[model samples]
Target chain A: MGDAGKMNTTHRRLILLLLALLCALTSGCRRDQDAGKVRIKFWTFPLWTGITGNEKDGTTEDWPRLKIKEFEKTHPNIKIDLEVVTWQGGMQKLDLSALSGTYPDICYLATANLPKYASQGILEPIDADMTPEEVADIYPNVLDCCKYQGKTYVWPWLCNALVLAINVDLFKERHIEYLIPKPPERGWTYDQFTEACKALTFDRGDGHGKVYGYALYGIPLSVEYQMLTLVLGFGGQVYNKEGTQFTLNSPESIRGFQFLMDLLDKYKVVPPGPAGMQGGQVGQMFANQEVAIESSTSGVLKQLKMSAAKGDFPYFNAAIVQPPHLPGYKPASMLSVGGYAIFKQTDARKRRAAIEFARFLTNEENCRALTVIGQFPARKSVGNIYPGDVDMGVVSRLIPISRVYFTAGAAELNPVINNIYQSIFTHAMTPAEALADAEKKANKILAQDALEKGLDAKGGKQ
Target chain B: MTGQDSTLKRIIKSRWAYFFVAPAMIHFLVFSVYPILSTVYLSFVRFNLQGNTWVGAQNYQVALSDSIFWKSLANTALYTMVVVPVGVGIALFLSSLIFPLKPSRQNFFKGAFYLPQVVSAVVISMIWLWMFDSAHGLLNYLLSTLHLAPISWLGESRTALPSLMFMAVAGGGGSAIILYLAAMGGIPDSLYEAAQIDGANRWIEFWKITLPLLKPTTLYLVVMGTIGSFQVFTSIYMMTRGGPNFATNTIVYRIYQTAFEFLKLGRASAMALILALIIIGISAIQFKWLGTEVEY
Candidate 1:
């Protein structure tokens, strides 16, 4: 009786063990099946990823992460990995990744960099993937920024227009409050702007007054677009109508360049040592109330307001106004557009997932969410999220007339212009001489770029 | 036949050792050797994300003709010339001063100096950037307190490279100091006692004994420092971006710009090769000068 009972118990134990192993094997196979899901990698800058305000308030879920979660919920077979890259050295990192064949499936491309990536054929044409309604939703002007050879390569997201940020307290202290444009569309002419700068600069005759009228950023590469804002405001266009030539030495551009030099050299309204300062330093000077006015983009409004709220400024009532225009020229601002583009992907399913994810990130609802973080939505339907926000309202009014600082050879042309501007700041060349030199160098670069891309002399794509 | 069989048996017995080293050897081959060989090949070709084409010495010709390349090389040479000797001298002086301290005091000074080495170069550059700001920087603030007009420490071309040099000399000698102190510690106390008996003073003993005895350490530090300073990219990138009319541009920084920003990988590779040769040549010269045999 004991032997029979023992045998039966041993057999039952073996059977149970076999069943457990079978279950484990089946679960492992299921895990492998889940791993087969299509995964897309997205790289973006910190601007699109909003600040993580108090974790307890649940503001930590930034728009990109939130959209990814919703996307995964609907498309159960797809997964997305988001990588946030800093603006500093971001382009270098992307270039290395592209060369090494390790680039993400999707990446954020600045409007100025779009041509470089597009011309190199590193970006896939997204026009076929975008629906007509989706294409129609984006502002026409912004959509134009994403096109190269009539093919859309990017899904345009949000944009920021360069504007004049004024310290109201300084204006009041200087008794130049009337110089602030009322409607902003009828901005102050160049003469009035110069007068305001002179009045705002306080020397105090004892080396004690540290305030300056303007915070000029002459650091190369980063501040070129800000410099271009002043150039465009004076009726100067960077490239001609066909985008074939650089007009940096034109009469209008020379006037603009001379005026900037005068602000630093002749009038001394801008702070000295601007050649070493970057965009952040200018923003900091404005925030610290050390400068009366600064030329900045719409993105700085949130920071100025935050600084005011934090009591970091002595008197921090900031106002936005359209950039000054010349007497006979129309008012204009430098429009900078940043958005997402799909990298060249060989897998059809993965490419579709990447494009879908990019669309989801820039759709109307998501863009509206992005607006709360101080980005101007690219869709006309969204409009101004904060109509009451004076700074944003001014930005909205300026967007219609603002001109983008992009050309076929923008990436190559930027450094040359920056070098010329720096030379002027260093007193190495007069504005006319610098502009003339820049025109020569820019044309050389454009010619080389055209030759490299197998384009004709007229700058048409091969 | 018996000897060969025993060697084969020994190798088989020690197979685990080879197995353990395989990962590291494979890593060195893949990351180091492959990249070096690829860079050599890329130096003679035009490369892009899509593909590469043979350009055959065209990049080298461009680099030789490029004025910016020569300026960057000169900047690098100047940086190395200034940073190596000054940094090494300061490290030696500090190490001599700290050598006589008690163990606890020595550790305290060592830790204080070595702290900068532990910090990232990017962070150091950023802190110095604020400190060198023209209007609000601490340096300018100090100048103002002394009734001196503020000098644009990093704005003007005259002071931009020097400001970077000052930063390099300040905290960059941490590792060198530690190395010198360690080398000094290894010196026998009997030599100092012998010199004292010979009526030699501290300065004479330092010159006749300490300086000569520390030649090997000095040589090592000089070679390493020259190599490090020759590739000064981070500080330039973070602080100046080789700006003020390329006043602070260095070989490595220019190579970085050419490769990444301009997407001229071929030219960047050529520049990198030139830099490596310069570093090697300078190192060989340092070895020839300071590498005399010192008998303990």
Candidate 2:
């Protein structure tokens, strides 16, 4: 052969060798690295940040790292790979991971989303692993949300309930201190709440413009749990008992929506353009004392406590209250619970290790951290985490009356429900018309979900 | 030789050149082409992450019947209509203004305008969110100074979509300006001098020489701006989230909601295909209307 032919043969061989090496390097690298140890991938949001509303803290990783270190200390043969995801895009990441069949063995699942994942058969039921005593200890209502069909899908960890946070300073300034519900007496009629809002809202010549009385995030496409709290308090439910139909057009629901519109238009208490207001925006108004009362969650109570402890403000005085109810109904709160769910695993040893770590992560010792964040524990035995704190005490007492605002296909209905608020606030649709339109849109979503589930349009078996 | 044989021979003769382009071609095939093909396939199936069931044309039917889908399409069209023309106009105006300045001054203005392009869209959206705040926003503050009522820039349905368009027209002209400036610099000054010798005023000269010459750039900017506006998601996701009754919900945002939030990958894929077709149709029209052969 010529010299050129020889060099060409060598080049072909070299290229073939390089392609093989690249393939070997890219495939199954993780398994080769961890030869002896059982590796369990655990995905989580920054849940226990030692303070409420501290999920966004740059140091959120510290608490999770400490816990992972403690878990590894006890189980030397098992290694836990911790991945912390952000709240904004974490669920979508989880969905994409599941679709790719590369999801973590353990992850924190929002309770509202548990049914959807469980129905997809991606979640491993924790019922077989959980002890009967442990099962009994968890609050029944919170535990119910973690279950799909009849099996427990998630290990309930921590829960946050929607509550009313009032700026006591503003109430005092309006000379409506008597209207503020005391800690033990957390009840008020809708009429009384409106009267108080009227008294508190006024144009103060302080150059900061008019200080409003109340605000609840009315933006479309948000969770709308704060608004749902009012609906529940007025004896309305977004979904029927079986979660099979849209019942927002019920007379009671329209009344609830009308009350909010009255607050915005008639009473002139809520800030203008509620359709744009978000939770952060409303929270900012409450903090600035521009608004006297706002719908919030127990997380804010924890945030206030942290601010007070750190002396972040001179006087950070706030109280937790319940949403006012109609004359015959009871005050209600909307609750959102988050917990850990184990993904389906074929490796028995890795699955057991993940379960053990999940248990350790939510044990009584670690659950004490929930108190610092002004959150309620899933277990009743973790009783009275807040012994004497008035705000948290009120929150704890309201758990029984707390309602879950989600069902299967709740994500699809978010924009539909948000439209009702937007239309009502913008006066594009009256309360009745908006509620009816929302019901129509919501039914279409439910019908699509039903079709996917092989059921009839009304959500019954085909 | 046959065409295929000649092509193979040509590739073999220029083997080094082919090797140099291999990585980029492979990247384009794997990342872009593969996903697009997969999306087209998924659009014809019932994909639930667990399994895929073939159901041809069902997802497309559902998308066609969905009212929100039509509303979002209209919103996207409206956004593209306003943003593309105004954005290209602003870029051309700014480039014309900056072209005659000293090189140092021109560079300063170019860098200042291009700063937003370098910054993250999410960060820019957050800044705009605060600036549009009803109570404490700079816009409202300015209105209050003039003794006018503070407008709810994002909260009211009437103003929400317009607010987004304004944000795009204001900040989106940066990159287009750089493109325009480069295109403008490439145009020979001899054309302008000829027009001036023919007793053409500056305005007439600009109308006759500068505009016709910049047709290629203008066409590019319009088509690209339309595509970008149709896919407006980050700002909507960050600032308004298609709020105030979904007055600002665009096609891409709706697709995201359907795919990620609703977990209906198949339906999302169908909607995406519909969007792709619409873009293709509109771009074809733009090309046929505005396309021209410019001579140096």
Candidate 3:
């Protein structure tokens, strides 16, 4: 070949290589800017996966993955990247992402976290995104959990209500099944509940007890919901109706705190050193038939059923009963609600897509389908999805009256209240002293938060 | 002008060397330097999702007055004091005991002690948590077999910190033992033989010849162990979560909770900077005291 011909051939090859390199570098950017397609990131904890069935159990796909698939099928113009953040460190990860401006477009928010995020302006309001009919389908109590300062921030998805669970096999073995109200209509009053616990408790005067009547979960950091339910059942409220004051030191609240202390210290119907046990430990104790009664969320029902199916719980079967109330007070259950909240995004189309995806995930059919994984749907229209299941039915019925433990500055209030309960349970402080100390500290935190946010003493944003 | 030209020419001559190190330099600059500077800056400001506002030294002032911060600091100090000396002592003892053994026996002992070092702190904490369970734990079960009453290891405030210390002192000190063994191997046999010719006892030999020779290794382990113990978070996070009325709360755990849980980034940064200073001070003091010139 001629020298000019060889030079031209080399030049052509170099140009082609440069072009390929450019394309490789810009391919991701090009896909991101593709016309008519909106990409949204949805981050959620593993609340649904591996709960019920997988390849091993021969059930359908994971619910969150399935919901994403279905949503994409209908909304072909949108793509969602589902990131399952493990529940253990999920909150810290989300908080760091939020601070770094790399937060997902849509994220899950719990009742305790909703107000904190909303107050920080990290979440966008979704009031205008929902249709009236869609809004009406959700029960008011559940829907209120997603609201802060008269603005909706999340699409209510599923809720878990706290209830009293009993070891039915143990009760029968002890012939104390009669103590449990029959026909599911009559509920246990304070006196009846206390008497039954005393009868069921058997201590052989040794260091160990073969069976304790109740497993009181006293892990301070995570026991707020359970302990608050007891306080509510005793006709006391942690906060006033306006959520502006810390009323934990009220006479009724003190009485409730005293009642718990009496249960642990005076009566000794509960296991020793209950302060050391978390929810999972208490569940394990119940499964092992060491504790006859446990106050837990509805999710425990599914856990118990799974254990029974696996033959791990062969010694006893579990049943759910209404949480007992004080003599003159009505029964109450503390509700834990999980839902989706959209982050603040500058792109209009992406925000719309995120909201629509959230709505689709929480829609009636999808919410009902999620029940297979053991979460009660937030929408009231599809009630009692677990038909013929007596325990779940009772939990479903109580959903209407359940109250959330969300209060302003709950992120700061929780530790303080938890410390008070820990003190009471550990016998470090009297109930009155603990209640007073908690009220003082919590009020100080509330005032500081209010001052920082320019809110009034009455908790109104200025 | 000529000197500047030569300097530029020298840079151009070694450009490939600079190019080779550019990636590492950039990574260190972006990750390490930037975070350190950012944390220092954030310590004087109140940061939230919205933005940051200057709060001056208020965060430090608040931390100084806060009882919880002091309590956590005290807990961390106590943990470091207990874990460092005991861990180093145990490692020294074990390494000495295994030094004269046959190769196979030495390997067996070393591997048995070093096996736990490979396990993650989270997993070890979980195993300890199960062992410390109040009612049905293996520790309590063993206690019951001996006709001893069960102790609430992690439940009561008096025992919670001690339980964590026990876990640290038991499963930890593995790497230190290996390091000590390596250092002991480097010691000259002539010194030991000379001491033996003088009829020096084994205990005197260990105290005089062996212990003095391992000074550098002990100093290194002491500094590292002190730093590690001061930053103890994973065990507390997985096991106690600073519970039972802040008995097991350490400085790192409290800082994490303040930053992420309460969103008090400014306060958390201040606490972190204070902890860093304290660690540096402690390390400096340790070097001054135990860091002797061993030129054998």
For model 3, report DockQ.
Answer: 0.31
Q: Give one clash count per candidate, in the order shown.
A: 0, 0, 0
lDDT (10s digit) by residue, model 3, range A1-462: 999999999999999999999998699677766556899999987765443454465422265677788898899899888888877788879888988889999988886688767877889999898899888988888888888877899898898778888888777777887888554533577677777778778854565457878867656444367756666677777787667788878787787778777778878888778667666787777877778888887677677777788798674577778778876666878777888999998999999999999988787787776666667899878777888877777778788888866878888777678777677777778888988888887887777776666622223221
Model 3 per-residue lDDT tens digits across residues B1-296: 99999999999999999999999999999999999998898898766667676778977987777677898999999999998999899999999899899989999999999999999888998888899998878998999899999887877888889889989999997899899999999999999899999999999989999999999999999999999999999988887778777788899998988888878888899999999999999999999999989976
Summarize candidate 1's per-residue lDDT along A1-462 as a digit string, tens digits.
599999999999999999999999999987786687998998887653243442333433375687788899999999888887777777878877888788899987877788767766789999899888888887777887788767889888888778888888888988988887786363778888888889889865665557788867667554377767776676777777667788868787878878888899889999888778876788777787778888887667677765676688654677787788877776778677878899999999999989888887787776776655576888888877776777688888777677756777676566677777677777777778988888887787677666556522233221
**lDDT at A103 for candidate 2?**
94
- Score candidate 1 by DockQ: 0.36
Please give the CA lDDT of all the candidate structures: 0.81, 0.84, 0.82
User: Which digits, one per residue and each the tens of the lDDT, describe model 1 over residues B76-182?
Assistant: 89988999899999999999999999999999999999999999988999999999998878999999899999887878788899999999999888889899999
Residues B1-296, candidate 2: write the lDDT tens digits: 69999999998999999899999999999999999999999998777555677768989999889988998999999999999998899899999999999999999999999989999999999999999998889999999889999998998888999999999998988889899889889999898888888999989977888889889999998998888888999998988888788898888999999887777888999999999999999999999988999998
Best by TM-score: 2
What's the TM-score of each model vs. the native? 0.87, 0.90, 0.89
What DockQ, between 0 and 1, does each candidate earn? 0.36, 0.31, 0.31
Candidate scoring better on lDDT of 1 and 3: 3
The best-first sequence of candidates by DockQ reads 1, 2, 3
Least lDDT summed over 10 consecutive residues: which range in candidate 1 chain A?
A453-462
Name the runs in model 3 displaced over 4 angstroms. Answer: A1-34, A45-77, A131-137, A183-186, A203-209, A220-223, A383-389, A455-462, B193-199
Candidate 3 scores a chain A TM-score of 0.87
